[model samples]
Target: MASQKPFIAEHIYADAQTGSTPILLIHGFNSNGAQDWDGQQWLAPLKAAGRKIIVVDLPAHGESARVDVPEDATVSKIVATLSEIIDNHGGKADVVGYSLGARLAWALASQRPERVNKLVLGGLSAGDPFAMLDYDAARKFADEGVTPEDEMTAMIASMAMGEGKDSHSLLNLMQGLGREPFDPSVEKPAAPTLLAAGLEDPMAGSVDAIEPFLDNNKTVRVPGDHFSALKSDAFKQETFAFLGIAH
Candidate 1:
């Protein structure tokens, strides 16, 4: 039996400037806020700008580790939980999400528009590649150290077994995420959005895969691959400007 807890591990960075709207930071799949933002030196600028920051460790990731996901834990449920977090903090937050976090953030913008002000999506595709992945394959590799020839499968398996991470919990989380029917074209989130795609990243088809969906987004090309993009200096510069932190 899985714990009924919401698995909300939150950390707050208070602004020196009073009444500043907070920005929510959501990390990618198999990553944590500490490594994604704090460890990567992102929090410094936000803190210096006197903007409150909120970072959450999503289910089965980082500090919110539970081996099994709750039965009722669907994508919608997770979005709603995030909404409540925003509401509790100050209401109407700006969101920044990377990869898996981007997917959830986009859903939040659609389903709970009132909770979001501006959205920033990084390292995202207009598709759900994870759904096509074999969770069993990833799990077997993590549990038994069996490697997969498939690049994506191998990547996921490696991340699942990262330092201090639980492979079983990742399997449970990935299974739940696999059930989500995500089609960005069919269901677009109408919000002021920014897309940070890496030029060398395969996910962006070398700047072609995202062409169809760039209508409303402000796209910026950063130098790096999928993982390295998060820590790119160009990405940080563009992101800071977009988020309205004056140079």
Candidate 2:
């Protein structure tokens, strides 16, 4: 077996001039910072907030496509690397994350509470989606374009096959993430948080399930499904209010 390389994802500061405490945007599975935040039209509003912005492509995704994910890696390892992004900047940030990004944000806040000012965790649910992934089925679909029999794997395939996506690295990320499943009850963050989920998004089951895990938190149901929620105006409004950014 070949040894795995150290995990290093790509990150970029989006603003030309430095301003208030930075806002770090983390994208979800099968998506990159550009598609999730830039393409979804999130940067403009954030820029108007008059704060330094930092955007990151998670390991094995987006600009970080070449980054190798070790089979035994866990979310903690990624969170630690993300923490360095914060440390390299101003040593703290207000985080906004969706789906898998939200899961990682939660872990980052819990592990390093001092580094996070506030959190906007969107499209998060109760159970671990990675744990449910059919790895072999997902890989087959990725490598050979064979449709997966599993519903979740099929759904993932559709998203992973998008333009410029590295399906193989994404599958490897899923495999690593499945090794340590996400559980909201463990190691919670005390920072003020806003948990928003789309009303019709099945992936985010009962957003309130996560309320107990956060000390200062608010939960709201926004319009649209998982994908649409990222682009929803309601989501932006609620998050902006929580972060004290103007509408």
Candidate 3:
């Protein structure tokens, strides 16, 4: 059975306001809330704008490492858990997410449209990349330091085996989520949305497939690749502007 430990969340309330709808920030795969959102300079400015914020560490990542998700977990299952983050607050929020977090946020908004006010999704495309990963090769390479013949497997293995990362847990997470690959057409959100992807990011090259689903949306190209896109000033400014927050 997957461990039922709760996800770790940090709530930062606006100094001058108490009842405003908060913003929920979700980070990408193999990343923590602090490094992804706070470290990227997202928190301070949002606070300055009097926006209450909730930052969460996804299960099996960062502070929530002890929370184990099964190998058969589906996107909807994880989405259900994320919805609790909204429930604990005011039952709804504006969401900002990047990469794998973008996929999850997309699922969250679709699964619970009423819970999302506005959405900012960055570094995302239409499908799940994890679905094509060579799990066996990745596991062997991560466990024994053997080189994986498959390039994608090797790359994912290298990422999972990084310092302070739990390769086994990360692999488990990827395998589970890949069970239900992302398909935007299945369920689309009704919230006003902003989609941003790096100009050189191949991972998000197929973002056009997701555009039609967003009735009220705008798309922007920021400078940087997948890894560096989150830190791009253009991406930050666009996200802040779309959310109506001063940055």
Candidate 4:
């Protein structure tokens, strides 16, 4: 069991540049900013392009920081933290979020459109099953590495654990997200955004399920599933191009 005490999110800046509008990178569940961006080799190129990269370790993933409160891992809270980051760096920047990070990005752009310039939401879909899960039961099943009754949730749990996440902490993350149906009633994310999904990736959900609800959007299909897609150079190409910093 890891420390449950709330803490500040860990973040790193690449090539700190004054007055240069930064681009924020948010990683997926069980993964940290280093693994998703720097480890994946995305950081160097963006740095070379003279872009300031602000990579965040979304609570308890990389650099092991917790939210302000144990129960504050919700998208709203995540966005609030992110807003603070953007504020510190001049209050408006582009954003790139992967998987679970993408979900939080959606909430951020929808709720704080002015804070985002160009948005790239990678690995997302219409519904989030984690919201429907029984946190306690799922956490227990995950600890055992098996949930016979619900294969999907079990696999998701396994994936989270595979990323080196403690089962209970991951459960806390999902719980902060709460169990709420996808809300289209909220204002659509107005930022210039791209929805990037891999054809083979069902784990990230379906782009079809929610793309229709978003305006000011472009869609791109890269060559790998959830994890691999992020590792793909094509994915990087798409991202760089969408961010308008592509070579």
lDDT (tens digit, per residue) of candidate 1 on 30-108: 8888889963367877988888889998888777746475344457777988999999988888899988888889888
The collision pairs in model 3 are none
- TM value for model 3: 0.91
Best by lDDT: 3
In candidate 4, stretches whose alpha carbon ends up further than 4 angstroms from where it belongs are: 1-8, 16-18, 66-70, 142-148, 162-164, 180-185
Q: What TM-score does structure 4 among the candidates reach?
A: 0.88
lDDT (tens digit, per residue) of candidate 3 on 1-247: 9865555445454543677778989899888888888643887788778778888887677777442555434677678877877888789999999998899899899889989999999999787768888888888888888988988778876888976778888888888888888888888888898999999999987888889888999999999999899888999999988987776
Clashes of each: 0, 0, 0, 0
For model 2, what is the error of residue 111's alpha carbon versus the real structure, in angstroms, after optimal superposition? 1.0
Instruction: Say what the RMSD of model 3 is.
Output: 2.8
The superposed Cα distance between candidate 2 and the true structure at residue 49, in angstroms, equals: 2.7
Of the pair 2 and 4, which is ahead by lDDT? Answer: 2
What TM-score does prediction 2 earn?
0.87
Per-residue CA lDDT of model 4 for 101-190, tens digit only, reads: 888888888888889998898998677777666555576776675464666666666665654456677667776775443464555688
- lDDT against true structure, model 1: 0.79
RMSD values for the candidates in order, in angstroms, are 3.0, 3.7, 2.8, 3.1
